[model samples]
Target: MVKDVFTNVVANLVTALIFGVSAYIILYIRMSGITQTIRRVIHPKQRVFALHDLKINGINRLEVSKFLSPLSEHERDILVKFHAARNGSNPHNGSSIRLDGISPVSNDKKEYTAHISKVGFFDFIATNLTAYPANAPIRSFRSQMATLMRSFRTFGLIQQVVNEVHKYGEPKKVEDVLENRSLANIISVSVLIVDATGRIGIVERTNKVAVSSGNFGATCAGTVGDVDFDADNPFESCGLREIKEELNLDLERLHFDGIVVPKQKMQPIFLYHASIDQTWEELFPIMEQARDISFETQAFYAVPVEDIIKFASHTRMTDTAAYQVWQYAVKNGQDNNWYKTLLLPFDVKRYLIPWNSQKDGTK
Candidate 1:
């Protein structure tokens, strides 16, 4: 009887071990799937922000590819109208381009006189007083037209055009909209949180602090500040300032991953990332010794790509800006895994490391 009992106990233990491992593998893969979904959403925005950031750090080839995909239905339509209007195909359908100081009119008529006047956007002044009639082709007219087109696109002419006529564009008082400048004060600082895979940084919290937080629930966050001018571009300067203040991280060594800005927001944020390969012995010492080592108040924690979707699905993440960041992370994470499977079959390595990990190398 004793021998039979021992044999049964051993068999049960072996079965338990197999079941535990199987459960872990299933859970891990499910988490990974969730992560991929997050990345796919985040990737496009990051790519765009990176392109706009002339001095952006840490951009890689995969991110570049995602950004170059075909424009969405709405974006394609807007682009078509914008391009056509600027080219004079249907310029008369919208507001005068003259407001942007880029009059599409050329001095092809030799007898026409030229006059200069400074006008604000949407304000046009036609000079009734002609200075001179010239036989020589006036270069200023063509130059002005080119300048205007550039300004129109740069200053978001497409939005203005669409807004002027759309029901959604009904003349809005600043008080009536959440997009009013007043909301700016609440989120005075903008942070472009990012991850190691060039994905937008995200975080999940059941606490109310996240709900009341300025823009998003993200672990690695940096506020946009004007304190320094190390880089000529705003995005680059902001990125550097944020890393220094928030993480006490030196941007010089971090690899440039990509920049991401969600299309829905007015003031864009740029995302950047770098890979860390050192063991805990070489890693924790440096991080621990950093100037601002505390994470208690900030609620800062790096999220792996595998857990992105779960983080994003929280009900408390209702802030539009925060939601955009979450969505961006999930989409881009998946897109990366999808392509990796096709390009390199056997190498299923995770390149992303969360900012917070135990001293002994556990999360």
Candidate 2:
């Protein structure tokens, strides 16, 4: 009897050890998968293309023309219903600038003309909310719309409406997509502010914003509203207006770096390198008094130019913001070897506008 009891105790001990080990292995595998998924969502694959060969020196170098296209019946209905369901109230149907097409003038790659149209803000919101890539955290835009429609108790009808409106018709080139009139392509400006001491100013966006909330972005950015439309220099005026609203400082030395369109959202953002006369130390107190600080920015960091790539490697940044930093670094003669030292999240394809392709609307 004594021998039998001892044997039973040993068997139980072995069984418990095996069970614990198996459970631990299973948990580890699950945790690892979750970590990878989170990483992909945070840093989706992005491709940024440079629209101009030379740095656009003057504000007037870019030209604009108005080309309006009224929204379809289905789109209009989606805009109204989605806005009401999402906000629990009527939508703000403000005016916004939509990018239609871009063409170089007289075979000059440096000079270009942008065709824009006025679109309602609610229309942009309705379309843009479902414009994310397939691999995004929220899955494809179709899935997201389906979930929202179901939650709003209009699943069957709204799903059919959205399906028809948001169809990715064919596999087209990037240039074709940019000029596609069907998409709600809004034009926005991203200003990268460099203080007198050569340190780059980066701001952390708060959770109040609709898109890219809690992510690091440019110093100040906003859509091209009606107030920002200048007959002579609309893009420049938009950039300056955003800076004034977000930082409360008037910047006169803004240079158009280039235009970048991130593949994730497929939105073209005009990037400007703005220089401030004050050092970051002196600018801090003034920034503290910004009218929109509480609502837009959570905090600010002054990073030296050399540490930009390193800083970006460890921190999470919006796709446009990260590309802006990389473009600035490259333009400033930063060594390309440094970029290879660390693995970056996005792939940037620099396409120079060929002379022949300019008139044909080809890249």
Strongest candidate by lDDT = 2
> What CA RMSD would you report for each candidate?
24.6, 13.1
lDDT of model 1 at position 260: 33
Stretches of model 1 off by over 4 angstroms after superposition: 1-216, 253-268, 278-285, 293-300, 315-363
Clashes of 2: 0
For model 2, give the 10-residue run with minimal summed lDDT: 347-356
Candidate 2 lDDT score at position 355? 23
Q: Residues 21-58, candidate 2, lDDT per residue (tens digit)?
A: 88655544432233323332333224455564644333
Candidate 2 TM-score over all chains jointly = 0.68
Candidate 1 lDDT over residue span 1-363, tens digit each: 999999999999999999978865554443223433343344233422222213322211111111111223354445444333333332122111110011123344212111111111111100100000001111244543563455455345334433322322322321122122111211112343453444443333222221122222443444333232223343345555555644555655433332333222222233444444434224434555555444312333344455443444332332333434444554565433323333333321232334455435664
